[model samples]
Target: MLIPPRVPNRREDGLLHFDLLPPLSLYVHIPWCVKKCPYCDFYSHAISSAVPEERYLTALEQDLEASLPLIKGRQVSTVFIGGGTPSLLSGDAINKLLVILRNKLLLTPDVEITLEANPGTFDDDKIKAYREAGVNRLSIGIQSFNQKHLDILGRIHDVNQAKRAVEIAMTHFDNVNLDLMYALPHQTKDDLDADLTMAISYDPAHLSLYQLTIEQNTYFAFNPPDLPDEDTVADMQDMIEMMTATAGYEHYEVSAYAKPGRACRHNINYWLFGDYLGIGSGAHSKITVDGKVIRQTRFEQPPTYMLEAGKGRAVDEEFTLSHEDLGFEFMLNALRLTKGFYPEMFEERTALPLDSIRPYLKQAEKRGLLYRDPTIIRPTEKGMLFLNDLQQIFLPDE
Candidate 1:
């Protein structure tokens, strides 16, 4: 059971309109973890008892059913099951979820479905069942293999578990991504070197390497650790990029690398500002309807989400993005690509003309924050290093 979405009284006037629609995707969030990681800012609750998997799955079905009106004629090309630990669910549950999705949505035959699995949360049997359940990609969170570093990061798995998890995932799936982080407290050049070397050795199809940033409200934020200095972190990033390239990986997005034609389709859609329907607790969604761009989010708390979905309306907040705000939000996502997006994308995705933000774009190019081209739009290498300033240009002055 689902209800129609609540659209605002505002019209698409004073905003750009689109004649064509962009690609569509789906994102599923599972918000429970064995323990809360100190550095994670994602909405994940640490569990003391067993996860309510069956009930959660039922709620997701209703949530998705409610979103059907937003994506009526489009075909879903990718589905990403990401969260606290999607792998924590039993394989049978994953199978049922996929079956439920297929029955409700028009998914492409070669749809790329990805699952985020923790090293200690899954086994060989569970993973193989996931493959059987239509998961073609597996993103294993192997932040670091060093036991001491793992402890510092509050990760439960050790080097052995990380290696074994990758091995199991690779055995069943062709598209495997290893999520690794660098710049730890007391981390040395040698420490990072060892981690990179180990990661490259695994030969994953994709790698998401990120720096350790202490965010607000996390444990690390309260009791900050001595992370690598700015220069060291930059050097580490440079080194990883060079090494991954040498190992035959393409540095596509800021923190993502992939083999030939192996980039994550779901993420690429997001970076390209493609539309997606996100279901489950705390999941966020952006969709286009009648040339207007609208965004919505379900209740952040799992209990609240379940209750709301049962009533056929799960959205806690919904708003139509203003023309001024759409330009800034689109830039935030598109600028993350190593190669800048095409000019056509601005109009097609945001339904706004490129000239709407031209003044800010000129400012960025004048400040040497971006390289402007008549045929293509992308950031200069300098812009890549200072992305925040480049994207800030598109932000409206309030």
Candidate 2:
């Protein structure tokens, strides 16, 4: 009930603009890592030697400059620097990027700046320096606390390294999130319990507990590991929910849990279908103009992205959402939340009357897959379990 006031209008004509609905968030991608994990499918490459820190920074700045027209005068409330290993960048590099953002964008003073760090690539000094450079949050990738499981997942960091990384992050950041994976190949219930215990011992403010899936184009897909069966994965999820709840963390999203007043604002922006600008290699963005929604993606490969920077070739794809597609997209993100969205937001964002979604809502309610009050539309327990089925209801009829 404590929603922030809408973003202010800065236009000279005094006309209301949909782009000013809320302050937009920003995502910057760092595409290099020490090594690629077998089950990972994100756009990233392994660094064989030294990182081209300066060259990459320049390219990123150029990319940001090119994106300025799409998001001019919008205040950025959150910035998430995610990638293969954002921690691999030196504090100076991070600072330089922040400076560029400050110069090019209207970044709020209290912007929630987050960096996704790989344990093996970060040290105490680097962690502290990152804080000094304006990173207010750290999301450390600690897939497992068991050394054997770490090896099986082909992670570069060991159990001890993950522990140290969390410890170091705690010293520098008040807002620290730990990323853990469950349902791994050959993982036992005891292994998952131990991993959760270790993570809880660190007392992180946020947690992203993800279930491992053998994604295509990864080594695991070619020579799959003997992962636990479906029932075990379900049990693992239940155990995680129970333990985290006991520790006073709220399951705000499907995979995210946070202590009181600690949920990630940036990701919340994402799930709410708020506007955001994405910069750097393989980044995607969604924006609204004149009540029409547009989706876009930047160049995928690093070399190609750098070459296209400032040349208008950096943007690889763009699409304007149809009325029905916009409605479906809005529901796709808003329904992912356990609480769902206010009934008014559907019409506000999608430019479709509430009646347009009424039939789908009625069907879902009849099926016991949705909970609808006069004010909000939310998924039921059954719907959460079979979310795909619930989402399909919103698809436009052919």
Candidate 3:
């Protein structure tokens, strides 16, 4: 094993104090995939040949080394390896990367490590090795089991492949999440219901149900597909919530459903406005040091990031969040939760007083978009439906 880099303690005793520091999570992005999906806008590149495994691993380590000083004392509560297709990396590579991360970061025992995999990617041995590599969760991307829908979505795997992936995952791991998209182009209510039924049949621990939307610069944006009308899409969302709840899964986040004690901790952290260190190409990090939050972004291109990592300067852009920026950011994340957030959490996470958004909160409540008690503040059913309008109230004042 390689020796980890030393973390510098740059804080003075008086300046280092924080009333409360939010939980830290690590997000490692894998930018390469067999092919890029059209509706997807996240930074991803298509690759057909061999993956540069060793080089990327080394770069990731150096990326962390450069980050150590910023997050000196906090412990990482969870890790999520997301991407173009993290499963594309070999099992041995995953083991090696986890080993190095464990050596460097103060990860808790029983830490939740998750990896995102596409259908048709892994088999029995690979899943087993991932479990051994300290990855406790697997999120299988099964957009839809309907063959026509799958092909329309440009998924490489067939319906059988998606089913087989889940079956193999169940045998090796207990915690699994299925990523399913609804309101796909030309999809009907029955089409969506069937997809949800198939997902529920597997009894995955968690499900991320998102509506497919055309993103700017993607193929779908230019050549928009004929999609379900607004009314039909709304019906689909309603059906999803009722069905998942009936099956005993909690509709936690706006688009997340999970069984008891099976919610995705990493994503929950994000929704709670918690801190995280992001690594790899186009990975973004939000860390609070000495009560001031700073953001950093690695080089956007894979080749550029790899080269920059060698010099311990993978971060191409970095900035401290303004007070107004912090307030808006906190609301942006916290309002995503169905159950909402505690009133005082705003201060703890963003170091901004709750009064910053008090006017907006009042206005939203008056409009029936939110419900506030003495302690907790949550979105109303209307707020969940018109989430964009509710969140817009919290934007930084001009």
Highest TM-score model number: 1
- At residue 257, give the lDDT of candidate 3: 92
Off by over 4 Å in 3: 1-17
Candidate 1 lowest-lDDT run of ten: 1-10
Q: What are the TM-scores, per candidate, against the unseen true structure?
A: 0.96, 0.93, 0.95
Q: What is candidate 3's local distance difference test score?
A: 0.88
lDDT against true structure, model 1 = 0.89
lDDT values for all models? 0.89, 0.85, 0.88
Ranking under TM-score, best-scoring first?
A: 1, 3, 2
- Write the candidate numbers in order of decreasing lDDT: 1, 3, 2
Candidate 2 structure quality by residue, lDDT tens digits, 161-196: 888899899999999999999999889998999999
lDDT of 1 by residue, 80-179 (tens): 9999899989999999999999999999998999999999896999999999999999999999988889999999798899999989988999899999
For every model shown, the clashing-pair count is: 1, 0, 0
Give candidate 3's total backbone clashes. Answer: 0
